[model samples]
Structures are given as C-alpha cells and as structure tokens.
Target: MTPSDDDRTHGGLETVTGAGCDGRDACCRLAAGVDRRRFVQGLAAGAGLLAWRAPRATVAGPFAADDAIDHFVPADKKLAADWVAGLFARGERTWYAGDDLATIGMPVGGVAAGQVYLTGDGRLVYWDVFNSNHNTGYGAVNYQAGRKPTDVVSEGTFTAATAVDQGAAIQVTVHGRTVARTLDGRGFARVRFCGEYPVGRVEYADDALPVAVALEAYSPFIPLCAADSSLPATVLKYTLKNGGDAAAQVTIGAWLQNAVLNDAGPELAGQAERRNRVVQEDRFTAVVGSARPLETAQEKRREPIVIADFEGDGYGQWRVEGEAFGDGPVEGTLEHQQAVSGYQGRRLVNSFQGGDDPQGKLVSPEFVIERPWIGFLIGGGGFADKTCVNLVIDGKPVRTATGKNAELLEVRNWDVAELAGKRARIEIVDAQSGPWGHVNVDQIELRDDPKTDAAIPLRRRRDFGTMAVAVLGGDASAAASIPDGDALEELFAALRGEPVASAEKPLGENLRGAVGRTIELQPGAEATVTFVVAWHMPHNYRENRWVGNYYGKRLASAVDVAAYVAKNFDRLDAETYAWLETYYDS
Candidate 1:
C-alpha cells in the first residue's frame, strides 16, 4: 500500500488513516478543537518544488464519461428541477451543471419563497443540527409578489429585489456559468404553480468546483439558518416554470423526515466504521521522524470493510460532545499532522475551527461554532478546558457535545452518504492571539446525522477478571517478535495465586510497569521470555510504535511511548492482529 497523505506510521507495520481529502493521517494526538502544529520548512520547500509536482490527473466530465440523466428540458427556459433538488439556503442556489446547459432559470416569489428548497411537504421544516439553511418547506408562501429577496446574492437580472404589492416575479438565470436574477420596475416576474422544476445553472472557480444553481436563491455559501428563527416563514416552493433542452435523472430518497439527531444516532456509531475502511500504509520511507506517525493510525494497511458507497453535497458535518481537560491552553484538532513536541521550523498551513471569524465561511454542509469552556481535573496537572459542540444545520446548531483533555476525539455523526463533496482544513496556528491562533479541537466530525450520539470517546473500564492478548502489526511475524514467553507464564501463575517468573526485571522507557522484564536467550540462551501485549483499538495501535518500533529509535524525553501504554491498564490487553480486510494496490 502507498503512504497516503493521511497515513501516519506508528512503529513499522501499522499506519494511521482516516477519511477527508487533504491528509489521510488518523489524528489521535492532536485532540479535537485543538491540534499541535510545527513549521516544516523542509516540507514547505519540497512542496514549493515545481519539478516535484506530479502530473495532475485530468478526469473526464460526467457528460464525457457516463451520461445518466436522459429526460430533456429546454435550457433557455425555466428548468423543471427533480424532486428534493434543494439549495443550501441563505438566499442561495447551486446547480451542478456540466458544459451541457445553454440557459437556466427559476420563478421565485419573494424573500420568503427563497428558502433552502421548495419544501414539497410542510411539517414545521427543521434542521437537526449544524445550522445551514436546509429543508425546503412548502407551507411558507413563496412570493409576496413585489418584495426584495431576503438573502439576495449576486446583482444580476431578477438582479435586484422585486417590488412589493404590484405582484411581480423574481427572475433566475445562468449566463455562461455566472448566476444572476432579474429585477425590473414592475416588481420582478416569477412563476409559482403546483409542481415545476427550476433549471440549475452551474459554474466553477477555485478549480472545477460548481458555483451556482438556478432554483437556488443563494449560493451554498448560505448562512446558518437558526432553526429557532423569529422571522416570517421563508418556504421555498419552486415550480418548473419551463424546461428547455436539459436532462435530469435525479433521485430523491425517502422524503426528509425529522431524522434522529440525538447523540446516539447512526452516523456517530458508524464513525469508527470509516477508519475500518481506510487502509493505511507504513511508508517505511521517511526514517523515524520527529512527529508521531501523523498523530495516530487506527488500522494498519487496512482495506475498507463496509461495501455500500454514499455521497452528497453538505450533509457531511460532525459534532463531538465531551469535556476538555488540562489547564492553561491545552491544544487540540479534528485531524492533524502528528509532529514531535516543538519540532517547529516548517509550517504546514493548518485551518483551525477555534477563534471567531478567521475570515472563514461555514462550509456548505455544516456551520462551525466552538466556545471555550472550563472543567475540573483528576489526579492533578491543572484545570481542563471544556467545550460544548454545536453545528449549524438548516441554519441552526443541533447537538451540544462536550469533551475533556481528549486529543483527536472521534465524531461519528456522518453517514457514508454525507461524506460526499465534503472538505476540511487542519492547520496549527499561533495559539497566543485570539480565535485566529491554533485552538485545540478534541474531535472533528462531518456533523449532520442521527448517529453522532453513540460515537463518544472510550471511557476507562474498571471491572477486570481476565485479560485477552492480541498483536497489532501489518504482518504476524513482526508482532511475534515481542518478548511474551516469560510474561505469559507470570500472568497465569499470579491468576492461580502462584509466584511467577519474569516479574521483576527493569522496564524500558516505553515499557513502564507493564508485565515486567523478559529473560534473555544468550549464546547458550534457551529461555522462553514471555511478554504480554495489549491491542487497544486506536490507543494501543499508538503504543505499537513506542514499544515495538520506537523503543531505542526516537530521542529520549519524547513520549515515553511505552510507558504511556502501561499507564492505561484497562485500555491494554494481550496484542492481537486486527481482523481488518486486506489492502490491495490502488
């Protein structure tokens, strides 16, 4: 397996991995809300190398490769949009058009009509969380005839706000790829009938990412619509005024119901499932580096286990609920590059979710808002920062999650389908200043799902009668190398209430109070040195690097990688090979 950008090598065999586009590294160290970043001048220099730039792959447009939609509607007229084709609303619209449409338009009534989408059914349309103007409603009267568009974007025809009272329509259009609405003297002209579709106009800037849609009143850059709004209903009920020669084979799944927006919903439970899918690689390439394999790796060289594929535009939002611990500016992140402590010099551009308005936008799918909090600590160190997470959905933040001193906490709110067209920026900025600095984010998630509830972090377990053993390694041979013979004997003897061997040897820096030392097999060495290894999911996976690989490799004073593992006895057990699917060459 190739070392994907997200790949974070632990010892030798296991590498951390996760979803998201830019970096695939499974961020375990850089906890949620807060991420640690170091300046990597060398990386910046290499990235600047024009010669090193690999040839970018040119993909054929949807039209050239596989044309699916067959029904044709004229382009030069109002388009009859298929059902459930909604705009992330804030006076917004975004039509995914290839170079196929010649023109596109939609008949909008007034500011109220310009909603997230024309809700065919009106059941007090709601947003579970991650407030973005979503859920088109039919109950709200679309146009008041002559009124300005509430969330007006772009100054095109239908360009200005329509007049009030004279009864006119708002014009929607797609000129080339630019989106423009109509505005005239007699209020704007609009069409409102039983059921018609609006033609989608598409454009791309920032690369080939689509920009505007016809029926959409605003861009996906729609603001977070407070689900608890006091304003008049802005129900977007669009009828297909006209359909030129355009084809649409859109599919509207079961009508949007008030999905399970609680903490224990499906999306959250399935969070770890994604890690199961991401097959990571140990780039045996970069010699023992300063940063821990990009923070952490859950499954090493793993292949995807789930089969069903899913996609969407802005539904992939994440929210984590846990308490933040530690005093004095404890750092965090969603997913981050795991660099050693203070290994600064080269700065990797990191996008932080902390700090207010770093001049950033609430991505189409989710609205990002984080508040700093305070919490009590255990066993001393200092006070811990706490946070309650809420994402904007349908223009409102849904769930409230809190966390404590946890790095790279997991958020499972995103379903497989919600991950479509989603992107995230993970950067470590200066934490001294305001929100613009590097704020720690314990967990980052694609928030809008019913399952975000159960995806909480693992709490320490106290009850223990027996222990299991397992190994974490790409190959069984390497895992077999751990000295477990003597350790195993001692553990069994103790369980039977007997004095066992291998109980009083010295512990390595990474080893801590783990089982004890193993007898050596000198030249005439015929000793079975039994050692016990524990295979915790992501945490134990992190330990593999310290004990198995980094024992004598990394600098001292670093994360006594092994000792950290020994500290969490409950989270440890005999090492076990991850029964993950195999990864084939991409």
Candidate 2:
C-alpha cells in the first residue's frame, strides 16, 4: 500500500490509514497496548509534533502478542535483527523513552498510561513517557543555527555586538559550562566583554562591524561537529565491497539521527523528504567507487552492514572531505596501519567550538541506529587495535573487553542506552596509535552474563558519577586496590598528555601520577581534551544518588594517598562530580 499524506514515519509503523483514525491522532492509534479510553483523552488538543524526531527500535524485536508490533516487514530477518529497527510499527506507536527524555508521568506503564499510535509508512512514532517504553527527556536538542552561526565566546572584547533574531537568546559556553546571551536590539549592540564559548558569526549589521571580539569566540560558523566538546581529530576507515552485479559509487558523510523532537517544523507529518532543520553543521562528503563487479551470494552477505570500498571497491565507495592537516587530504586510502594519529591544531580550546574554523559544532561522527540492539560505533574499523568503548553505570566505572585486541569500536548487544547516563565519561588513550575511536551501544545480547534483562536503573544525581576510559592500547585496573596495568599506563599518557599546570610540577600531580600510570596523556599539538558525562536529564534525588554510587569508585584513592585526598576532598562536602543542567537537580 502507498503511504498516506498523514502517516507518521520512522520504522514501518505509521499512523492508521484505515478509516476512523484521521492521521491527526498519530499517538493514540498505535497497534501496541494502548488503552482506548485514555487515547482520546491524550489527543485533547492539536499538538504540532511534526518538527522534531529522534531515537530507538533500530531493528525489530521478538513478536509477542504483547509487543503489538504493527506494519513492520523484515526483508531478511525479524525487526530484532536490525539493532536500529522500529519497535512499534504502523499503528504500533507506543515506544520506550530515548536517553535524552526523562520519565514522563508518575507510575506510568502498567497497561493504563494511554494508547499511543505509530504512523503508516514505518514513519512517525509516539508514546506515553511513563508507559511500557518508559523514560524520557525534556526535549530533543538540535542545531538552532538559522539567523546566525554556532558561536563560542572567547576571552577578549568586541568593538560592537551583532544583532541576531530579535530577542532571541544566544547559547554561550565557558570552560565547559554553557549559558545564554541574548541580543537586546535588532541591530548592533555594544560590547566590551571576553571569554570563549559562543563562537560563529554572520555579517554583523553595524558600522563598527562586529570584528567578533577576541577570545570572544570567532570562527563565525562553527559546524555542529565543532560544538560538542568531545570530537577528537581522528580519521575513521571502513571497507565496503560490491555485493551485487551492479557497479556503483557511494557518497558517504557522517550522518546523525537528529534527536531534537520539535513538533514545530513544517515537515512534522511524514514527508518523503525531510525539510526541517538538520543544520548540516560540519558536513563533508566522500565518494567511494569500484571497477570490479561485486557478485551477490553467501560469501559477501553482510546484513544492513555499511562497509568501506574493497579492491579499493570496498574503500573506493567511501567519501573523503576535510583538509585533515598532516595527510593534507586523504582521498580514498585508509591505512589501518597508520591510523590513530594525534590532533594537529592549536589544541588548547577545551571544546571543538573554541577554535578558528572547521569548528566542532558541525563535525558530528557518522552515527547509524540499527535495530535489535543500538551500538554506538565511531571511527574506522580495526580488529586488534581500533576504537575504545567505555561503560559507566550510575556513578561508577564499568569494565571493557574484546577478548582479543581489535581495531574496531564496538559494544556488543547493549540493551540499555549503552550506559549513556547524564554523567558518564569516555576517553580514548592513543599509545599504539593504530585507530582509537569510541562507540556507544544501547542494546546488547548476553555474551557471557546470561542475565537476559539487565537494567541500568535511573535514580537521582550526586557527587554524581566517576569517569573512566577504555584505552585502545591498554587494559583497565584489575581491582581498585591494585595499580593499573601497562596497557592502562600508556593509555593514561595519551589521556593526560602533558602536565596541566606545568610539566615540571603539574598541578594535579599525585592525581595525575595515579591516572597517568593508568593511561598516558600525550603532549604537544594535539586535540585539547576535556572530560564529558553522557547523562542529559535528571532523576529524583534518590535516583540520582543511586547513579552516583555506581561510578565514583574510580575517584577514590588507595591507602595513604586515599587518606590525604579524602581529607582534602572532604573540604568540598563531596560535590566533586557535578550533576549540572536544569533538567536534573532541579
């Protein structure tokens, strides 16, 4: 059947085009276990939910009658096979919450929340925040770069201030903290301030012409990749071959599953084309092609797999963009041997947006959400020396493994948001320097632990969570009481780089020693690194407290050192790891 004009989109689950339901009530029409009475109650007003969209259900899961899957068709296997498949299909709207959304209603789920509906063409999805697919965040975050560009304020003064959309507040950041700075008039506003955070600019509508204050964050157009303080200057390589007789060239770029669920955009009602603001912040494209024909059959069968061109057909179809510094411009050769290289830029601006151009705001890693289980995959692929995957639960650090060393970033079958808490930290320690990217997984099959339904609980916040790293060239500590291994040692060197205060007598000395021996921090012109917590929304005090207990063990020292650190740290009243953001701790 053809997709209707009002069908919701995403997975095969769209709205109910079969009479009675008028495409408008997309939520209440889902085939899932939606309560009919409450469905009507929830559809009281016309909520413009078209503008935003985001995550979950990459592939399909098991089809239990209770699952209430609607309008989903698996070409090769069930939806569960595709890690990023849709849970609720057409008329199967109700789904669980994404990492960003917080828990919606009190005491949700339990077959009584309200009926949710899915759109018709494997598109549009809706669900009760508290219902079966629970947990939710305030709203999806997106690049709001329209009138102006992504900005990062620096530490200097500007001759004048540029006018953005009237009364619109601009996002500003300092160190790692974020805030808002609004324009008073429609034209140039005066200025004499300094600090870095709100970079990016458009032509200032003024006489003095906003030369974009100093450290006042210049780079007029920081790409989205340049905004998130986490992007590292590492190149990823993939290998895709011709699996079919048809000869073809592939255009590749880092794509994101834009999570901002703003029902405000005009494209809200499932459209063949997405016209809303995806903001293409840091969009670079590469083309991969092949001369030899790829025959279809069992040998080359990779399901929903995205590979780089081989023959140099696997590596050829991949696209290459960016000046990429040292290598000048890598058109199509991804040498797994010479992979993990250090950043060659200024390396001091804590975040990506704090730079000159090619800002991080636009350079998001290429992300794809598969069904069955969502794995956070980043960078190129390697078997022995590749990317690192870190896991943080509650406020504690979890262990990472690969059985044998590999050059690929992976987290097998993660069921949770792959430990994407509001406060989880992941670091890449590049010692062996082959390829050291990282990935985040949301679902995982039990490889060792048979505990089928392993749930990472959500509570409040606290000294919050501890930080940890999954080094590409090393291993983690066997036990907190013992020192880290050699693998972790080199890893720390890459992480610590040079001393913070000074190499001669670095400020966080003892702490650095403990961590450095754990993983090395490389020095010189490299990517300026900063610690990051993945958590976004907040739980209640109790929930937050549970999260803190889960990850903070790494923060504690051993024996004598522990005592000294403890005494001094106690002076801060245990608020070490911060749980900032209005969504949480409020």
Candidate 3:
C-alpha cells in the first residue's frame, strides 16, 4: 500500500516546513498570526527592487499574489506566541489587547497572572496556578495581570525591588529621568493582542550598571482560547551594553516557582505524583503533571469489534460533558479557512460562537478493546498550544492526538493492540481557557486493522530520545549542586551584593529551580548559556498512560531549537538568537 498522505511536505534544514499545510499550495490556509501588509513591506525592503517611497496600497506587482506570501515566509520565521490572551487591569474596566499586550490604557487594580479569558460582559474568567481547567505548562500564573514577586532581587549588577503585582517589573530610564514603567512601576511597556498572536511584550530596563540593561518579555498568545497556548510563559529577552572603560562581569536572574500543580505546597509526598522536575541541565523542559490513580475494569469479550459512529442527529452512545454543543445530535461545521466536513454525518464542537474560556469533554460508552486500531478525525484551533484529543482507557488518559494551526480533520489511528480484551473509553477534550478554546471531532471508529493506509504512517511514530544542552566555561560541579528552592535566591543575592557561596548541602530535585548554568561576563564581554528541556512522553498505549500531549510538539519544537543552538552555539550571534527565539511559533 502507498504511504498514507499526512497532507504534509517534508523539507529539512535547507527549506523548513511549517506546521501548516504544504507551503507550495496557494490555497493553503494562512497562519493564524501573520500580518500580510507587514510581510509585503519586509519583502520590498529586503529585495530593494521595489520602491519604498510609494504607498503600500498603490505599490502592487508580481509578488502581490495571495499565495506568494507563504512561499517567502517559512514556518520557523512566523511570529510565535505562547499566551492565549492578556489584559491590563486598569480602573474598573479590563481592556483587551492582542498577543503583543500593547494596551495604551493605564492599568489599575494590580496585576494577577493566570490563564484568563475576557467575556462579553467584560468579566474575566481565570484559572489560577494549579487550577486544571484546560491549560497546562506554567506554575507562576500571576504574570498575566503583570504581577511581580514581593521580594527584593538583583539581576546581574542591578538591584531592584519587586512590584506587588502580576506582571513583570520593567523600569526604563533614558537620560536622567525615568521614561518607562510610568504606571506605578508596573514595568508594563506594551500589550498587543492581535495578529499571529505575538501575545504581548512586558519590558523593564535600568541604568544602574556601567552598562545599560533592559529586559523585554514577550508571552505567547494562542488565538481564540487555544489549549495549545503557552501557559505561564514569558520569553525573557535581555539587552546589556558596557560604556565604561573597565570591563565588568554582568549577571542576570529571574524567579520561577512552580506551586506543585497547585496541590497545596511542596512538602506533601503526594507532590511526588504531581512533582514538576526539570529533565536536563542547560537545555531543560520540566515534566509537570499529576498522575491519575490506578483503577481497573473487567474486560468484556467481543469477537468482531462493534463499531461506534455519530451520524444524523445522534451522539451515538457518547456522553458529553463540559462545553460541547451540536444541533440535532452533533451536526455541521463552522468556517475555519474552508468548510470542514463533518465525520460521515454529524460532528460535535465547542465554542460555536468563537467565545473565550472554551473547555469541555466528550466521553464514549464502554467497549472492549479487541482491535489494534482506534480511528477518528479531529479539527479545531485556539491559541491551542496544548489542545488535544485524549484517549482515556478505563479512567486514565492512555493516549493523546494533537494538530496545529487549526488543521482540519487530522486523521489518526492509535496502535491499541496491547489493550486487546481490555475495556476502555475515549475522552475527547477541549479545555482551553483562552480564546477559541474549542475542539472538533468526527468519524471515530474502532477497527481490527491498524489503519496502515492512513495518512500518518504508524512506523514513523517512534520517539527520537535526543535532546541535550552544551555549557561553555563554568564550574560544572558548582552549577549542578544549586538547589531549586534557594537557587534563585542565591543567584539574586549574588547579584544583590552578597558573596557567591557554594552550597554546603548536596543538590536534589530542588536543583530544577536553580539556574541551570551561570557564567561570569567580563567587562565589555557578554556570555550566554544554552540548554535543552526535553522529555519523551511515554506512548499513551503503555500501562502508565496518564501523560497528555498538550505540549504536543511544543517541547519537541524546543528540543529542535535547543539542538540547533547546541550545534551552532559558537556561530550564533545575538541577532540570530533573537530571530530564532521569536521565530518559534510555540
């Protein structure tokens, strides 16, 4: 049989392929967060073949083809976002901004970070850190409201007090007077919430050191409440320059604390199951999740597997929960690029109105897992940094399926042969707290065959198990021994004018909190340390199948970036690093 058509084209280093449809197709859907006008201007500026003085509207030519834009911009070059949505709490009203968080209004009522969605009534729906509504991957959730820690901290040679708010503390001084962070020292510079959902940028700068130092943070914003939205995520971009005659060592530090899945502090042994551990040094991706307790259900015997389908005005034997909706059972599809075909007849969907805080679940009736295949079509989009179709066996999520850029009807079939003779159920989930936090599902079928003819080949599903970080010059032992709890404190303290002491106590999981690496920057010289955060999620079909694919390709994408950086660390300049950091669409 021919290889299944996954509706994708493979192009490695020479020509990168984005998560969207084949780039060659003019009909391919545009990415959710790209600006066409800005793209055109960039092209003209780069080529220098077009006149820049002419107005954009009047200057149309060969490159104006709608499909032409996709050819020029690769997926890796797209404006990446991590947050689903953000707001500046000002006065009595909460003003909405695009991914950039470029809110011009004055913020009030203080900032509290967490996954939040603004409703039609102007009220905000929030799930504080530890709340499992539909988002994952962030621990310190107070950043959304521009909240800062309540302690004094030092970054490099700069010592500053934390803001008593949710957003980051950004203080910029030009000349002699303070120019930015004018709003009560909140350090909020911009909050743009539109276009490719760059999320928003929060900035803090100071002239305390011989060199001017600035910190700009851009959070990812998933469009339309996508579960794929990066939670508690802020890509902190730093800028430092030396103007003094003597060279100096510069240090930078930030506080990142995980509340242990909000399971009531870090002392509990139960925190073990819910523990968040950084998997690697240099490059790292923390595995933060709570596992479901084990439970068993008697296996029902069945010869030829009975099929379950949703057709006409019926949801079949499925029980729906959360915010799922369908007319006359589950029917029809909404406009997303083009008309999405319903599975066979009817389809179930959430966020029909494209509302925010879109979250819900669809559970199927019990059935014997006598076959090696479970097939279905899933389509939907959000900031969806983590949206997924979770296959819950017995009671735990045994497997997960995910798509990108609002992909329509991504066909998938899991190898469930090991579960044969076992009883199971499927949980189609769409728990997104941001905009477009919805899911689309159709044509779910159980088959004895593995659907080898499907678009995505089964054999290509193995994990690479490859992610590593490279540290330059540093005391490896000292760097490794830092404890997570006191790591940030110690680093900040060192920068805050205290002597850098070696921890007398041995290192432990608390090491996750410690900065993975610390390097001394000599006067007029800057140092950068890079590492990979990699975790290979055990295939869901295994016995311990509680891990979800919410991060899906998110962590893997980081792995890819980390790998690139590791290989090209010496060659990568600040300009290239900045481009790659923002280029990532995760």
Q: After superposition, how far is residue 57 of candidate 2 from its true place, in Å?
A: 74
lDDT of 2 at 291: 11
Writing each residue's lDDT as its tens digit, candidate 2 over 1-586 gives 1112233332222344445545454433323333322233334533222321112333234555544455354333453322222222122322222210121111111122121211111111232211112122122221222211112111111111111110111222223443222221232233221111121111112233211111111111122322221111111111122222332222111111111111111111111111111100111111110011112345533343321111121112222233221212222224433322221211110111111122111011233322222222222322222223333444343533221122222223233334332343332211122222221111222121111111222111111111111111112111111112332223223223432221111111111111111212122111111110011111113421332221123223112112222233222212211211111222
Error of 2 at 489 (Å): 50
If scored against the real structure, what TM-score would every candidate get? 0.17, 0.16, 0.30
TM-score of 1: 0.17
**lDDT score at residue 50, model 1, on the 0-100 scale:** 29
Instruction: Point out where model 1 deviates above 4 Å.
Output: 1-269, 272-432, 436-438, 441-586
* Candidate 2 residue runs with Cα over 4 Å from true position: 1-191, 194-453, 458-586
lDDT of 1 by residue, 128-149 (tens): 1211122223323333233233
Range of the 10 consecutive residues with the lowest summed lDDT in candidate 3: 83-92
Q: Rate the local accuracy (lDDT) of all candidates.
A: 0.21, 0.21, 0.36
CA-only RMSD, every prediction: 32.6, 32.2, 20.9
lDDT tens digits by residue: candidate 3, 1-586: 1112121221100112464325543322212222333334335555242322222233233234463566764334222122111111111111223321321211111112223332111111222322222323243542334332221112111112211111111222334442322211222222221112232222222334344443332333334434323323323344445444555444433322222222211111111222222233353432222222112222532333435555546555677665544432344555442355424444444344344364566677787876666766666652223456766775787877754324355555666777778888877666665534566666666764422223322222222122112222233211212233333344333323432222221111232222323334445654433222222221222222234334434445333433433444344334334543455422
Give candidate 1's whole-model lDDT.
0.21
